[model samples]
Target: MNSLKIVSLVFFVRSMEQIPCPCCGERLNVIGSRRRKYLTSQSLPQVVVIRRLRCCRCGRIHHELPDFLVPYKRYAGEAIEPVVANELPLSVAVDESTITRWRQWFAERAEHFAGCLESIRIRFGYGFVGGPSDLSLSVLQRIWHYVGDAPAWLARVVRTVANTNQWVHTRSAFCPSWQGYTIML
Candidate 1:
């Protein structure tokens, strides 16, 4: 019986630790209990039983995982988008319905995930937000939108463009406009 409990613990951690506790801000301690339910699969509906977890500190129970680890799921957090896209063709990639679910889920939990990403960005630099070469477009857009104030480096770029003297004419083609470029800085 003790060995069985240990085995169940191992499996629960393996499957569910990808999500952290929403209230306590820590990984949940698996409860080692299973519930049976019918789940829809690609081909047909199937009955399955899944393990659930509860936070050790807050004691809030949850069955589904976090969204960052999952691509298009609101509950069953699984993979990042790049990993999913790598397996499938870019054109016929993950379903739009799944994407919509993820978007809604993230919006609902925006504060937590946004703070997590912002801390990483500030600690390791903007490049660390995604990566050097393959920065995710959506991530970049979110960073730009939520970063609030512009950094000194970006301000310098804006100043350089704004100080250019090509703007002698009111309607000159060579004039630098501060519309799109202003928001970047």
Candidate 2:
């Protein structure tokens, strides 16, 4: 599960009570942590320490992710936003194939993301007023209407979908690796 900004790992380690297991609704206990390599907004590689939490009831483990990181992607959301919006990045930090892959990944899920946001707005009655038709709106624009244009909008989307249990995982549910945990909330 992802938090907006991890001001302190100590905060998470001490505040597990505030976090519930996404799978079982049980409290999560810190088991350990793992180091992951992530690209910063400037496309520089950095190592981040992610804490792993385990559900006492289900014995499943989840990684606590920061807002800047997108699950299963190495680049920060800052670096990805421009590319997804079709804006040319100031510098090429990755190969062309990776950029293409990012676009494809987003395109594959854009409609689903929009649908989920729409459903949330309707179900929760978030005072949504009529705007442009969906056909005339980009995915980002649709999201803006629902959640406003927060800088951490992508992270907001990830958290919202995960919390609502509407996330579309790329991995097969039947896979062994997919059995235990989900996106941390």
Candidate 3:
């Protein structure tokens, strides 16, 4: 089943009736809890119990993640910030290959994120202003402008884009192991 990630530190503390379903706009109900393990900014391991909420109207399950965590990423948001900002001498808990992969992932989605943020700005009736050629940096700058230079910037971006239904995610190919197999669409 496909599940949505809700980034909120006080998700559990808040009343379930107050939390609306991101997909269907229905009230959410507390379903269960799951333990998530991730590395801290210093590379130390930590575990957190996150709540699972269900939307009765849509029958969709949502994972409530803390602001420090990023969906599908094992590293803390703070640890990944330096890499996204292009800081030198990558130093973290993970291997070099992992860091390389993170860099590549951000590179692939940076432009899309910039475009989404731009669209949001325009949707709010803001005047159209030209963006920099370096859209990735521009996106980062805009995010900073919106949310300040907080350590949880990445998580905040994830949450924002996700709420707007513009979050980009990697998916498997249509034909995962199609060896000369063709089908009509």
Backbone clashes per model, in order? 1, 1, 0
Candidate 2: regions farther than 4 A off: 1-17, 89-92, 128-135, 171-185
Point out where model 1 deviates above 4 Å: 1-22, 25-29, 32-49, 64-115, 121-185
Write down the TM-score for model 2: 0.72
Tell me the tens digit of each residue's lDDT in model 3 across 1-185.
99999663422323333767878788788888888888877787777788788999988888776667777898888888788877777666777787888888887786676677667777897666645643555656766755567666777777767766675545443544467776433
Please report, as a residue range, the 10-residue window in candidate 2 with the lowest summed lDDT. Answer: 8-17
Candidates in descending lDDT order: 2, 3, 1
Number of the predicted model whose TM-score against the real structure is largest: 3
Which candidate number has the best lDDT?
A: 2
Clashing pairs in 2: 1-184
Backbone clash total, candidate 1: 1
lDDT of each prediction vs. the true structure?
0.40, 0.74, 0.72
**What is the C-alpha lDDT profile of model 1 across 83-125, one tens digit per residue?**
2223344332346775565455444444443445456556657
Worst 10 residues of 1 by lDDT: 160-169
TM-score (all chains, Cα) for each model: 0.32, 0.72, 0.74
Please give the ranking of all candidate structures by TM-score, highest first, separated by commas: 3, 2, 1
